[model samples]
Structures are given as C-alpha cells and as structure tokens.
Target: MEGHPPGLETVTLPPYSPELQPVERAWNLTDEPLANRCFESLAEL
Candidate 1:
C-alpha cells in the first residue's frame, strides 16, 4: 500500500464553539418540529 505519511494533528477551538458547527444550528432549528409533532411512520418523520 502506498499513501502519504500520517501524523497526529492538533485541533483548537474557543469556548462556546458550537455556534460555529452547522449541525448544531440545524438541530436547534429542528427542535420545535421534532418535539411538538408526531409521526405516524418512519417515512412521515
């Protein structure tokens, strides 16, 4: 197998960094629809 060398990398972030994550924003936006609504089937959800 041939591939580029691998090494550990360090990631840094500031406190309260979830605001920068898109998935977090999406989850927050979907909270109301997911909570107050009921789905009859998996497809409906």
Candidate 2:
C-alpha cells in the first residue's frame, strides 16, 4: 500500500503477463544494435 518505503511502489501482475517482464521489454532494445550484424562465433559475440 501507500505505507511502502519512500519512493518505492509495489506492483502485482497476473502469472501469464509476458509484456510486464523486464526481458520481454529489453529484447527490442538489445536486438536493434545487432540487427543484420554478425560475429564469427559465440565467443566473439
């Protein structure tokens, strides 16, 4: 509730909500720089 620590907010989400996950939101940002780019191997990447 409103009594939570200062500047902190609590959120609750349904179990199946993929859009709310951090990684789900980060994919586009991470993918944009790598689009059409290639590395010789996994280690290079």
Candidate 3:
C-alpha cells in the first residue's frame, strides 16, 4: 500500500478543478479510523 495508498481508501470528493472555490480538496480524511468512535462525554473527546 505504500506504493499508492489513495487508490484503495481514498474517499474522492467532487471532481478536482483548479477553477473551483477556495476549498482545494474536500473529503472525509478521518472517516475510517474515527468511525464508530465515541466518547462518554464531550470532555473525553
């Protein structure tokens, strides 16, 4: 996977366009590892 990790797990956002808004790229970068993750309280998080 070190060769290219994005091909497997990348959650591709909208079609990347240089002409788009200031948001360079928008994707849930923390979706997998953070999935089903919770804290008993806000302080715990």
> Against the hidden reference, what TM-scores do the models get?
0.45, 0.41, 0.27
lDDT of 2 by residue, 1-45 (tens): 888889898889998888778788888899998899888999887
> How do the residues 5-39 of candidate 3 rate in per-residue lDDT, one tens digit apiece?
56575445568654464453434564666679987
Candidate 3 C-alpha error for residue 32, in Å: 4.5
**Candidate 2, lDDT over the whole model:** 0.87
Please identify model 1 stretches exceeding 4 Å from their true place: 1-16
Clashing pairs in 2: none
**Which 10 consecutive residues of model 3 have the lowest summed lDDT?**
18-27
Candidates in order have lDDT scores of 0.75, 0.87, 0.60
Q: If ranked by lDDT, best first, what sequence of candidates would result?
A: 2, 1, 3
3: Cα error in model 1, Å: 14
Error at 27, model 3, angstroms: 5.0
Of candidate 2, the 10-residue stretch with the lowest lDDT total is 18-27
* Models, CA RMSD each: 5.4, 5.9, 11.6
